[model samples]
Every structure is written in C-alpha cells, then in structure tokens.
Target: MASATEGAGLSVDEESPVSQKREERLRKFRELHFKRNEARKLNHQEVVEEDKRMKLPANWEAKKARLEWELQVDEKKKDCVARGEDYDRVKLLEISAEDAERWERKKKRRNPDPGFSGYAEAQLRQYQRLTRQIQPDMENYARQREECGEDFHPTSNSLIHGTHVPTKEGIDRMVEDVEKQIAKRSKYSRRRAYNDDADIDYINERNAKFNKKAERFYGKYTAEIKQNLERGTAV
Candidate 1:
C-alpha cells in the first residue's frame, strides 16, 4: 500500500523529452520564419523604390544645373549693364578656363559623332532600319517555298532538306511582330501628293464622289454654261 502511494505521488510525464525538444524547435522555427518574412518585406520595398528611381529622367539633374547657371549669368549681365560695363566682354570674353572646358564638353554632348566614322557605319544603320521594317509572314513564305519546291531551295535530297521546319519560338515571335505591325499600320495613312495638277474642290473623298456624281449626271447640260461662266460671259 505504501509503494502504490509512492507510485501515484511520482506523476506521469505526459510530454516526453522528444516532444519538448520538438516544441522548442517549432517555436524557434516560427521566430525564424517571422524574421525571414520581415526581411522579404524590406527587400521588396527596396526593389520598388529602385524601380521608381530608375523611371525618373536621367538628364533632369543636368538640365536643372544648366538652368541655375543660366539664371546666375542673367543676374550678372543685369549688374554689368547697370555699371555701364561691356556685358558681352564680362559674359563671353572673360570666361574662365573651367567654363571653357565645360562649354566644350556640353558642345561635344550636344553633337556627339556629328559625322559618321565611315560610310560603312551609315550603310549598316540604313540596313538595320530596313531590316526593322521587315516583318516576316512565315505562312506565306512557307506557301511560296512549297510552290517553288526545288527551284528556290536548290536541294536535291528529299530526305535531308525536304522541308523547312519552324520552331515554336519563331512562330511566337512572328505573331508578336505581326500584332505590332498591325498596331503601327492602324496609326498611319499613305500621304497623298500635295501638288497634284487636278484641282481639289471637295472637302473629303465622299464629297469628291458626290461632286463626281453631280457632274456626271448634269455635266452635258451645264457644259456650255460652265464655259461661258469661266469666260465671264454668263448673265
């Protein structure tokens, strides 16, 4: 009876050592996770701020500095004029070496590579501009190649160069390029000849068509009257 009482007094460990360790690990993990989340939040905010800064105009600071310099110069010119001194001499002729160098740098920036390094560079730029305008129609090109067959491809082997296979990347690029071209074409119209010999007496194409119909139906009856009116003889 005394041994049973002693056993009952020694309480049972409902949580084992392993479970205590696991609970401790879990609490540590939760703290680390919270710290990681805070770090990620900070990193995201930094990236957003960086993007905003990048979107600002690069030359804005330079422009502001230049404007400030101009304002100071204007004030100096006013003082020179008041003192009956030569403003041009004070402004231009009396410029320091630093100012001269700065002016040269500004001029260089304004007209960087005013002339081409070589004719080859000009040719390359022209070629690039032409190539940029070339939006490939793969389906049409394929159809043409099929029609031409050996005539265009110049292939003898049926097994080797049977047909040109397009990649998925190429197909997607063509689709995006075509959509861009369509968008560009929508914003543009063919400019008509400004110095046409024929007189334009209508406000628009529709008006021009209406005038043509009126003239066509009644031209014969009014022809003599029109001629007489032109000669200032129609009363």
Candidate 2:
C-alpha cells in the first residue's frame, strides 16, 4: 500500500506541498514580528530621548532629590494608612532649599515653542478661579459627612440634615459673578474681529472707552428728546 501511494505521488519524508506552504507562512510571520518589535523599540528610544531633552531639572542631582522627596511622601502616606490615620494629613517631606529653588526656576521657565495661547491662559485662569471658589466649601461638607460616618454608635430617629445655607455675602458674590460673566460674553461678541493673540488688556480698555462714549451720547439724546416733548416742539 505504501509503495502504491509513493508511486501515485505521496511520500512521508519528501514533505507535502501543504507542509511546505505552512513552513513558509510561519517563517514570514516570524520575520514580520521581529521587524515590528525592532520598530517599537526604536520608537520608545526616541520618546525617551525627547523627554530627556525637555529637562525638568538642570542636573541629575536635582532630579534625584525630587524623586527621593516623592518616594518619602509615598512612604509617609503608606505608614499613615497602616496606622489607621488620615493619609491626607500625612505631610510630604520637603525638598532642600537648593532643590526648591531649582524647582521654582524650572516652573517659571517658558518653553521655546509655546503650546498655548492667551485665550487658553485666560480659560485656565477662569477654571482655576471657579475651582478655588467652589471646592473648599464642597470639601468641607464632604469632610463633615465622612466624620459623622466614622462614629460606631447610631442614633436612631435623629433627623439630622447637613445645612449649607448660602450666606448674604455668597449670594451677592453669585450675582456679581453672573454679571461679570454676562459682561465678558457681551464683550466677546462685540469684539469678534480681534485675533487670537490680541492683547486682552488693550481690547478691554478700548471697549471701556467706547462704552463710556456711547453712554454719554445716549444720555444727551434722551435729555434733548425730553426737553423737546416738554417745550411742545413741532412734531
């Protein structure tokens, strides 16, 4: 039977055409995988080099100090958690004066190529102002509830509500905030021709001047109309 099959065209050691095709496919797949891996490594190395060029600290010593300080903060937080205390209360280790100065200098340094514009800066300031205005009150309320939860004893049927009644000052501030926002939006609509890099200060000053002039002209026109009506002038 084996001799007959061999004569017909099938042989075990001669390797079947299907097996040869499978071997070729596998070899091509391995070569493709190796090339992809090499490309990925090269890309990663390029990213590392770019990050190195954008130095956060001038020297290795400053970088080392920053890392050590961060690690110390992490350890402190862990220890606080282990002791069943509030991790937020765990203060991070402060950097040395030299390191602090280095960090501040780095912080103030502007990139040669700026990625953001004045509008972006204004938006960021608005965002920070809003956050600062709202977050502390919210956090205080949350902290109060959390502290209440830490009690082991439950007072049944005690109707206790967290009261965060807005004060008069807060209400006045809210109204002022709304007015300011309306003014800002109105100003933006009126000054639609200004470019992205246009100076906000200059635009504001010009707008203010125009607004004052418009107000004076309107006031005088209204006064003349009232005088004409009282004097029985020709209609």
Candidate 3:
C-alpha cells in the first residue's frame, strides 16, 4: 500500500522537460493573443486621432471664409459711401425739403372728410381712457412712497429722496406688480383691438414730445445725429 502511494505521488514533475515544453507553448499563445489585442487598441486610437486632425483644417477654413466675407461687405459699403450718389446727404436733404413742400401743398388741396374725424375721435377716446387708468396708479404709487417715511432709505448714506430699502419681500412684490401691470396692458390692448394705425399714431406723438425735449436739452448735438447716421448707417 505504501509503495503504491509513493508511485502515485512520483508521477511527473511539473518542471520536467515534457511539462516545461507544454507550459512554454501555452505562454507563447497567450503572448501572441495579448500582442494582437494591443495592436487593435493602438489602431483604434490612431483612427480617432486621424479624425480629429482632419476636422481642424475644415474649421479653420470656415472661420477664414466668414472673416473674408465680412471684409468684402465692409469694402462695398465704403465704396458706396465714397461715390456720393445715394448717400450724399447734402443733396438728399435739399430734395427732401422740396418734396416736403410739395406734400404740404397737396395736403392743403384735400378737404376734411367725415371718416377722418370719426377715426380721430375714437383714438382720442382710447388715449384718454388709458391715461385715466394709468394716472390713478401713478398717483397712488407716489402717495404710498410719501407715506412710507422719509427715514426709509435704500443706502447706508441717504443721498436720494423717495428711496426705500427693499427687502426680499419688497422686491418680490415689485416684480409681481410689474408682471400684473404688463398682463393688464396686454389684456387692454387685446380687448380694444388696437391695430398698427394706433401704434403708429402713438409713436408719432411720443416722438414729437421726445424731439421737443431733446431740442431743448441737446440742440447742440443736432448735427451729431446726422453725422453718426451717415458714418454707421445706424441709429
């Protein structure tokens, strides 16, 4: 029994020639598999890097084209202004003045129409109604501010009157009030079916008032507006 056990235990040493040969073959197979996998990973990374390099030139060309287009437009504008054909303000202003006088004479030849008077009356009524609605709110706001106490100032050193130190609640209330006012005005306009004609009339009236005030305060810069408009083609 002991001889049989010893024979079983002495079968084959793993470090022997035959066993070592088999182990070396397995290790070679594993190394080949590992090298193939490493090659595939490197190939994939190279493809990604090549794609990134390809996009760079395309982006740079697009940016260069946009800049060139802007330059061309600017050059064309400069050439047009230099020609003094359409953009000659001195000639244009003289022509405009003559056209204005002709328009005035044509307007005088026209008689008063009943439809015009009716439309004017309707617009006046709408304006008066809106003014009345806004006036009370304005007056109430002023009264409340006055009643809030003069000592209630926004800054540490009070240099301005009618200023209130707004808390978080006060700011929230103000935002709500402004939103409500906007909603009310939107509803009012919708209900009244206010059209472009009403908007144009309002703009014209407001512009007239603004022009009067501007002339009073900034008449010295009257030529500046024209010069700036000529140079920049913007208001």
Candidate 4:
C-alpha cells in the first residue's frame, strides 16, 4: 500500500518542463506586442499634432488677396464698358513706385538674363493695357471666323515674337500652348535662366544651334511642316 502511494506522488511531481517554458514564452510575447501597439498609437498622435501645427495661414491669405484683386479688375472692366469706351483699349493705371519695384524684382528673379533688364514694370503695364484693348476684337474675330467657316489666324504686331493678336479663342489657345512649351523647356531653360553661375552666352549659343537643327529637320520634312502649319503648332 505504501509503495502504491509513493508511486502516485512521483507521478504528480513529473509535470513537463517544456510545457511550463512554453507558457512563460507566450506571456513574454503578449507583453512585448502590447508595448509595441501602445508605442505606435503614441507616434500616430504625435504626427497628427505636428501636422496641425505646421499648417500655414499665409497661403490662404495670399489666395484671398488674389481673388479680391481679380474682382476689382472685373469691376473696372464693366465700368469701362458702361462708359462706351473700348474695354480692350483701357490702359493700366499707374501703380505705386514700391509696387513697380517689387514687380521688377519678381520678374528679375524669374528671368535673370541681363537682356531681361529692360523688362520694367512700366513695360508690363503697357503690355497688359494692349492685351486688354485687343481682347474684345480677338473674341469678335473668332466669332466671325466660326460663323463664316474661315480659318482664324490672328497676327500680333507686338515686339514679342509669336504674340498672337488679340482674338479671344486665339489668345486663349496661344497662351495655353506657350505655357506647355515653357514647362517642357523648363528642365533645360531653368539652369540657364535661373542659375546665377550659368553663362548666358553659352545658353544662347546652345539655343541657336538647337533652332538651326530644328529648322533643317522641318525643311526636310515638308509633310510634317505642313501638318504643323495647319495645326498652328509651328510656333
């Protein structure tokens, strides 16, 4: 009887060490996972707070100012029309000297070429005035062309090459095309135009060489040239 009881006690003491180890390991794993989740949650909150703090009010203000200026310009245009004056021929009113200088600085920053030095605020104002004057005629021309089923080709007498004379559709189309070309050429032109250390003469020379090559290619491809002419893509 005593041997049977001792055998039972031995059996009870023989619990598996591996099972105990596994339970401890599982506990540690759960603790670590919980800590990691908590840390991630804290990090996310920090990011949200940082984003809120970094949001700028300046851009909103600038946008508001631009909208106000546009409204004022539209009001002036309406007044000119009411007076029976050619709204398109209205000249730019004189701006303050400070504003003019600021505009000049901005222009210089955009196109740093010494050749661009002659581009004063006064010149810009004059150009704007001319553009305004021609806009109505351009619209009328486009309307007429569409009505008559004629090709609409407007020519500009402005000193700037390729400035299409004011016709609403023509001006709009030309401006869009010009903007696209500017973006396409930005990679090459930015370095030449904006880089202070860049040599302007070298840039000009490269442009001249490229233009000559383009001209030669266009001359050889008469069919392509004709297509471009018809599409108004030559410019």
TM-score of each: 0.25, 0.24, 0.22, 0.25
Q: Write model 3 residue lDDT over 68-146, tens digit each, in one string.
A: 9989767766876887555345445557777989989999998543343587786886566556554245655666677
Error (Å) of candidate 4 at residue 206 is: 21
Off by over 4 Å in 4: 16-19, 46-217, 223-235
Per-residue lDDT tens digits for candidate 4, residues 140-225, read: 76666775452244346324345335558666877986796588768655443456774343457679568667768775767676
Q: Candidate 1, residues 6-48: lDDT per residue as tens digits?
A: 7766544544667889999999999999999999999999999
**Cand. 4 Cα-lDDT:** 0.70
Candidate 2 Cα errors over 4 Å, as ranges:
1-9, 13-15, 56-235
Q: Residue pairs in steric clash, candidate 2? A: none
Clashing pairs in 1: none
Each prediction's whole-model lDDT (CA): 0.81, 0.73, 0.70, 0.70
lDDT of 1: 0.81
> Among these predicted structures, which one has the highest lDDT?
1
RMSD of each: 27.2, 25.7, 32.8, 26.0
